[model samples]
Target chain A: MKQSLFEIVSNIQIAENVFKMVLSGDTEAVKKPGQFVNIKIEDGGLFLRRPISVCDCENAGGSGKGTLTIIYKVVGKGTEKMSRMKSGTLDILSGLGNGYDTSLSGEKPLLIGGGVGVPPLYMLAKKLISEGKKVSVILGFNKKSEIFFEDEFKRLGASVKTVTVDGSYGLRGYVTDAMPKDAEGKDGYTYFYTCGPEPMLKAVYKASKTAGQFSFEERMGCGFGACMGCSCRTITGSKRICKEGPVMEKEEILWED
Target chain B: MGRLSVDLCGIELENPIIPASGTFGYGYEFAELYDINILGTFSFKGTTKEERFGNPTPRIAECTAGMINAVGLQNPGVEKVISEELPKLSRCFNKKVMANVSGFSVDDYAYTCERLDSCDQIGWFEVNVSCPNVHGGGMSFGTDPNAAADVTKAVKRVTKKPVIMKLSPNVTDIVSIAKACEDSGADGISLINTLLGMRIDLRTKKPVIANKMGGFSGRAIFPVALRMVYQVSDAVKIPVIGMGGVSSAEDVIEMMLAGASAVEIGAANLVEPYICRDIIEKLPEIMDKYKIDTLKGIIGGAK
Candidate 1:
């Protein structure tokens, strides 16, 4: 419930309609692997809030205060306006949604994401690396132009693999295809963490050599649980993607019907 | 000091902020995140007799300063709501929660009312009559004056609880609709639900939402809501709960001045979870700066 004026530290358009924005704010509240922040792009009436994934939370960078970094794609009016914003403070509501559970990530951890879904993987990759665990990322995009942050994931000290629909990239196929095939059926990875479109998630769920975590995306009214705009069925029952999780264990995830 | 108490149908709301129905789900979900008893009463989701699955996929579409939704009255039926949801909601807030109910036929309205009659936890009942997504329910009974009165009469016969008729803006004459509800024994009126809107994808050349048409709610619809509330308040005798595109504290004051006794924030809640609380706190400061004493005197005051 902490609202602060987050100055835009940096913004980079990784791909068309896809941008990565870094805002300087109190990054303490948001301290999870798969959490989010609700950003109001326009100052005027009806600044329709958009939910962006927490890319990184910097505390001791230059000043010890803190800075919240969010990564999002320009989907609609809010995101489009957010792209035009340059080095100004925007009212940000951070520490939203139940983030990823890192305790579950075992010795060998694998992360998979498609397009904008790749943002949360960066945070999870950092968390996994800090714990002295082996981390691997299989990044997927429609084409080479849509691919982003391939080298960033590598910098986290994890094995990063890139895949593209067109043959202009590394694996030149789906992330599931790019998965370490030699390690399949060898109990190589304890858990699998993934985020992307419903189709991509379904494919990852199908291709996984082991059970772990999967996140779902839905049309959200409130990024919090108030609106009930984002709900997905799980093994237990109907759970809110924003509240219960935007990231859930693979065992708990009830794939799209 | 800020005047936090507001009377909706002679029932005092601790604060003026009432969470719009369909937005707040029985009050338990948000109660876990924050204190529910902090500011005001929360209006539970719309309930009918039979359970509904709501509209098909792509029910919502983003607009310029707002959104359009076709959520077709998805609920667990009135019986389950009274027996289940009410018990859960009582643990969250001590305030008498407002029940936002909907029905299809004349019998549906009466049946739903009868179920909620003995529930002391519910102080007021808002009959939602402006849902454009429902075929024979929402706007069907709203547009016609006779149909509006008939539903009001049916509900009044069953429940001693105060009834507030939520009127839709998708009508030719809103004044007539407001007057009809009051004449038939409604205790209050909630004006200006979403306006009928449609958006098309230029590239695909198809409707943006799965359902070609949807109900638009957001800051873009505020002016129309204000005008309708002004007209209805002048025409009717009951209290009016105004809504539609209310995002900020200033918008709440504008709705109150335009004729609303208490404003229900719809799209604004969709934008920010804490926005209603934000507006409620800032309201008094606005009132003090304007040199206003009571909120009652400002209703229908142009300028």
Candidate 2:
């Protein structure tokens, strides 16, 4: 992870405690599907590092070595403090966690995510389109207030579908509820990929017919695997959420009720 | 400009700003971000005899200027570190690495040090006696004068390496603990691991950390950290590595003036990922502004 003090091009509060921060840094190591950046919020104010989903990666690893984006909700003090920070500069540890595994994703694939979890899905959707793959995304949020990144995904040419819990927008229900009922019928979907809360992840695992990958959101310490502070039990054994995955295969997930 | 170096025991460091353990992983990770050669020496993660999974969730919490951690010395075991981690580290960080060894008991510390004695890449042995975050090992061995002495003496017996015993700040008498380890044959002393701290979830009526209690560090504790370091330095004649909530080069100046020969940037590393390098680069600029010519002049100059 490159800990660079990136100038904030823009930082906006999308929801109450949720914010979207765009920064300039080494975006080259961030080309993959499920990668994340560990954000150090409020200089040295917040002790623990906060991990946010990579909304998109720009400039890859070129000379400019350009921009990085992350969207997060104020789950606690870290994000709450981050929201108060107006546009200026950010000292950040970016390019953390093993993102998504794109090799298993076929030409025609399905992506699903909910709420703040939708951040990384945006990057994954764009990647699939770049690979000349037919990508479809199902996104869910609590309500219209929680919705984010619709037009951007559309601009990427990924067939994007939206869902909400309050019947406020798109398909009125959860993302799983919006899963093409004909998923088993005709569409040639090679694999499934998803991220969100544990509940949404469980739904994605249960609803998908084909094998998929899930990005698990966990409170982290080092944000690297060395701490073993973010390990979640899987079928194989205990795996570090930051290392083995914030992204893990659907088959390996051990859903905790 | 003289020897930009420090001799901790017989082991020579090109400089004095070693990256504190836990904050700096095996050095390769940070080396990938920037050149590790710029550093004096980096302390590796605390390695126990057996593999340690570390503490539970909510291991870190941010306070005013610093953060607290309950990482519980999570490591991949001593054998794995010597075999796997060390080789990877050798390729990246050209500087000597002080192996910060932590254990639950005195024997544990000795065993791990004995294992590390064979590796020449290890420039020194930093016995982790000051961790307030862990349940049994940290301040438990550091706070008690007798235990601290016993643990230091045991490790010194096993190896010829210069052993620097890290002293905790959570005790009633910080000087006593530092003096205890020094009297027991420690080559040097590192002061002020995070102080004991606690935070509450007012909304939930529970503690914020899963561990209920954690170690506090950062800008908030600099004054307290300086005081302890000053006291410990006066109490003992050994070289001291002082750190609390050091974030900038100014803090480094203050620490050295207070009597630390070197300083470790702990919570600052968590805050600014490039702090290890940032501080090193900033030190020269800071030194220039203050009309300082030698790195040695700043130590113990406070009136």
Candidate 3:
């Protein structure tokens, strides 16, 4: 992990209570698509750094200075403080968590995301499409106005499906309701990858036919794995979410009720 | 020894900045970011006789100027720690590490401590009698002077190395417990572990931490920690390794003035991964600003 001061290029509201922040910094350490950056908001009496997964990144290799794109929901004080920032350096620990493994993406891979979880999958879609693999994305939100990055994903040469529970746009109900299945009633994608609330993940886990990867979220202290504050039980016993994951292979996941 | 050096028990630390256990993991986690050999010595995660999964998710809660953690002492157990973690840590860290042990019973403490005593890399055994997150043991022993003494004596019997009893701040009388450990053959004392604290999510109408309450730590608790260190160190003959919200080089000097021989940076390290290194690097400049020549000279100097 590398700690650097990222200059905010732009901070704009992309959706209600949601933001798309573009930052320029030393992005040399950010290695993969699903990896995250922990930003220290030095205001509002916040103590711990807020961990936000990478939505997309550019020029992030070998001493390359790059720009980072992150989508965040203003649920609490930290993000609220983050949403108000116009311009200045924000201290951040980047290239954290075990990001998605593109090598595991088979020919036809499906991406499932819900709400804020939609961000990380943007870069994943870009990666898989660039790899020349057929990519299908399912973006879930509460309603139409809450939807984000749909056109962005569509422009990435992937088949995009926007699912909203209110049926205000695209398919109705959850992402699982739109899981493309073959005549054999098996999920059509060769493999699947997902990020979202746990409930949606559980539904996707049951609906998925092929093996996939799941990204997890937990309240973290040190987002780089030093503190065991974000531990969760897995098939391999206990693993720190910040270190071992924010992403885990479907086979290793042991979901907690 | 250089200006930053201080004697922790009989072991000489190049600096007094020991990363408190739990926050530093097994050392290599942070060592991956920077050279950890710059630290005097870091206390590894709180180990137990058996592997612990700890509390369920939402184990961390954010508070003003600090955070509450209910990690519940999750570790790979002592055997695996000796077999697995220490080996990984040995690769990155060259200093003699401090092993922090916690348990549900006196025998459990001795068993884990004795098991780890054979490891050469461990310079001291920090018996953690004060973990607020666990039940049946942990802070239960720490609240009572006699129970704390029993665990201290039990671990002291098994380990030949310096036994520093890590005290909890949740107690009504911190000095009595520190003195009890000293009387029971504790070579040193480390305080104040996280104070018991809780936070509630207004939206959910529930506790922020799934465990309901956890150890509150960070800059918000520095004054409470300093006061406790003053009281405990003044009461005990053994050296006090003070911690709890210690973040910067200036905080380190203040802790020493309040009767701490060395300082451990806790929640601050969570915010800044290189905080200990930063503090160790800034100590001399801050010391020079205060016209101090050696850090050891400031221990208990305030009185």
Candidates in order, interface RMSD in Å:
2.5, 3.0, 1.0
Instruction: Show how many residue pairs clash in every candidate, following the order shown.
Output: 3, 8, 0
Cα displacement (angstroms), candidate 3, residue A133, comes to: 1.3
Stretches of model 1 off by over 4 angstroms after superposition: A14-18, A43-46, A59-64, A75-77, A180-187, A233-236, A249-257, B1-6, B29-40
DockQ of predicted candidate 1: 0.38
Native-to-model Cα distance after best TM-score fit, residue B263 in candidate 3, in Å = 0.6
RMSD of each: 3.1, 3.1, 1.4
Q: How high is the CA lDDT of each candidate model?
A: 0.80, 0.79, 0.92
Q: Measured by TM-score, how close is model 3 to the native structure?
A: 0.98
Which lDDT tens digits does candidate 2 get at residues A1-257?
A: 55667778887987646788888766756656677877666553456667777887788545555988888887776777777776777766666778887778887889888888888988888777878888888889888888878777888898888988898888888898878765555654788888888888887777778888888877666676544556666798778787678889877877753
Ranking of models by DockQ: 3, 2, 1
Residue runs of model 3 more than 4 Å from their true location after superposition = A183-187
Q: Evaluated with DockQ, which candidate comes out highest?
A: 3
Candidate 1 vs 3: which has more TM-score: 3
Query: Candidate 2: which stretches are off by over 4 Å?
Result: A1-26, A38-50, A65-69, A74-93, A151-160, A170-173, A180-183, A221-244, A252-257, B1-3, B202-205
Q: Between candidates 1 and 2, which one is better according to TM-score?
A: 1
The CAPRI-style docking tier of model 1 reads acceptable
Deviation of model 1 at A21, angstroms: 2.4
